[model samples]
Target: MNVSLLANSLVGSEIIKIGNEVNEMKRKGAQISNLTIGDFDPSIYPIPDELKEAIVTAYNEHQTNYPPADGVLALRETVSGVLKSRYALEYNANEILVSGGSRPLIYATYLALIDPGDKVVYPAPSWNNNHYCVLSSANGVAVETSVENNFMPTGDQLKPHLKGATLLALCSPLNPTGTMFSAEQLLEICDLVLAENKSRSADEKPLYIMYDQIYSLLTFGKEHVNPISLRPELRDYVIYIDGISKALAATGVRVGWAFGPEVIISKMKSLLGHIGAWAPKAEQVAVAKYFRDEAQVDTFLKEFKGAVQKSLDTLYNGFQEMKKEGFNVDAVVPMGAIYLTLKIDYIGKTTPAGDLLKNSADLNFYLIHEAQTALVPFSAFGNDESVAWFRASVGGCSLEDVYAMLPKIKTALSKLK
Candidate 1:
């Protein structure tokens, strides 16, 4: 049987590839309390009345024509203001490019810059899509740094893999574990990459850095971190990926923007101009309108932080109780994103097939079957060696429900000694 090499190299998502097998069990009269799927609570963030009005107005006004290739002028202008206010980044509208979601922005970045066989570096147990997107779309190798160090990666990790490298996709206040790099730590990385780029010489193109700030508004207690803040000289080499999904709970609208040097944005926009043709015209107008009124962004951010904090507290308490109950687990506390990693060891407990539970994937399946809870195994996130670590997303459920889900999770592994 003949198949594509890239397709062969790609790994499927254990979390979703399970294909509703558990969900089907859940449907057939089973009490399924879902702890999987990192969806925000539907109640806290409903579509705003203003956005509804905009959509209707667009429909009535027949604003249905294809938009400009880059994005609507107002949206790009608003994005410029957002970068200035939030990250202290001075971006012109030309540097702002919009896509359906940050996922495409990643691919667009890869398409805009990468040559075949370029080496790409990222921190591990990362967003699954980044790895695949680089490998499948760009045919680039992904250099993964271990998450054992509280998920803060260093330049040393990239040294061995920089031979033909072109892009470094970085996500802070990252997905899965929610860890953010300290300002100093981010500087350490950029300094090294830029130095390495110089040593390699003028013939070699610069190593592009794409910083994903999708969860920018969700940070609580800790200061917001960005590479542009520290390394001003690398402005041309940096790309910022941010969105209103988490900020406005508008994930359904799939709006995200990229901020970078005008040249890179110009290249990416040329590509997106053909396919995306301005990010959802109606949604762009609404965000643009809202940008004029800072009060909405401010109030929404406050509520967002509050809702996220309440959920984090509930999950923290859940882990604490489990610890008190003698469960062997580590709390990988996150600074921003809605989820955190829980490392569990189910060793010596034995498995149904007489094979000892060996890795995170096995434990994930067992929990979903026996515990009736869904977790994104570290295995899915590219950590296969370690056993019994999985993620719990708190924002998807309310505080009480989050507390309630913990006991259900504990139910499966309680018998372990």
Candidate 2:
């Protein structure tokens, strides 16, 4: 069973492990309200009809061949226009590199920028930057953030770590917490990055930023901000990760793009090219045609985000109600994305079965079995196991499911001593 050290030491995804447990329970006839994975159940949230039809059309037109290593030029052009129209950021097609999904683009970013033992600074409770650092052989620094900042890292917390870092990974409408960085918050961090880079010699590797805004379009009412937009001078140092996976409920469609300095993007392109990670030609073609109609895209977002918000609101309000009822539970207001940050502070409590709820994971599994509900603990996202926070993704459940699960959770908690 000897394998490469990298393969042997690599840890599997904790979220996926929880999801697999949920799936196994479901297969055994358990009616589990699985909120572990950050994915949409197509039944509750289907892709836009226009986009789906375009995908079919592209396939019918025989766009089934492998796409160019970077991406379909038309799709890149459409992405360029999207940046201009949506975010007021400007990046031409050549500067954009599209891949199967944000994962490949993210991994490519790491491979292009990191060398073994190079430091990679990222906030704890982020999506997968820790694993990406491991895969890229970079020394990962997970800065612990406080709930006061909604689990998003502050400049002061990250400043001391940026001294010799090769990459600073950031995400807004951040995963796990569904929190976002305010303009002031992001601008502060951007200034820090600028200052750090300014102090570096040209011969030394500059600190690059990998900004993941995959949920940028999924915001509730808050504005999504980016480093480049706040500090235009930092444009060449940032690489953006975005796509239709979350925006269009098209995770399976596998079309994501990264745009930055042409030189860095070209390096990422070559890296991904060798890995054969291009988005399917048909899907790329379909996305290009569908995204060109801004009005149509806006119409879809208006309705889609409305549904996602309803689910998030239901869960938030339910937890707040429980808190008012003297439960040791709370929730952050839904800001963006399909997740609600929940505080189920029953870690030290004991279940009626006399088993001590030792940590967030234990409490989570208790709810899964007793409440028939599931969630991902912050520990899975790099926090200490004692942290009682968890992420409940609403994309897999309907508003009714969320409403129904609240009473079950209340009942389950009531049974805990």
* Best by the lDDT measure: 2
Off by over 4 Å in 2: none
Q: Model 2, range 1-417, lDDT digits (tens) per residue?
A: 589989987999888888888889999999999899899999989999999999999999999988999999999999999999999999999999999998999999999999999999999888888899889999999999988999999999999999989999999999989999999999999999999999999899999999999999999889999998899999989999999999999999999999999999999999999999989999999999999899999899999999999999989999999999999999988899989999999999998889999999899999999999999999888888999999999999998899999999999999998
Give the clash count for each candidate. 0, 0
- lDDT of candidate 1 over 134-239, digit per residue (tens): 4536544445555565666766776676555677778888777777888877888889777867778777788888898888778878987888789888887898
C-alpha lDDT (0 to 100) for residue 54 of candidate 1:
69
Worst 10 residues of 1 by lDDT: 134-143
Per-model TM-score versus the true fold: 0.91, 0.99
Q: CA lDDT of 85 in candidate 1?
A: 81
Which sections of candidate 1 miss by over 4 Å?
1-10, 129-148, 351-355, 385-387
Clashing pairs in 2: none
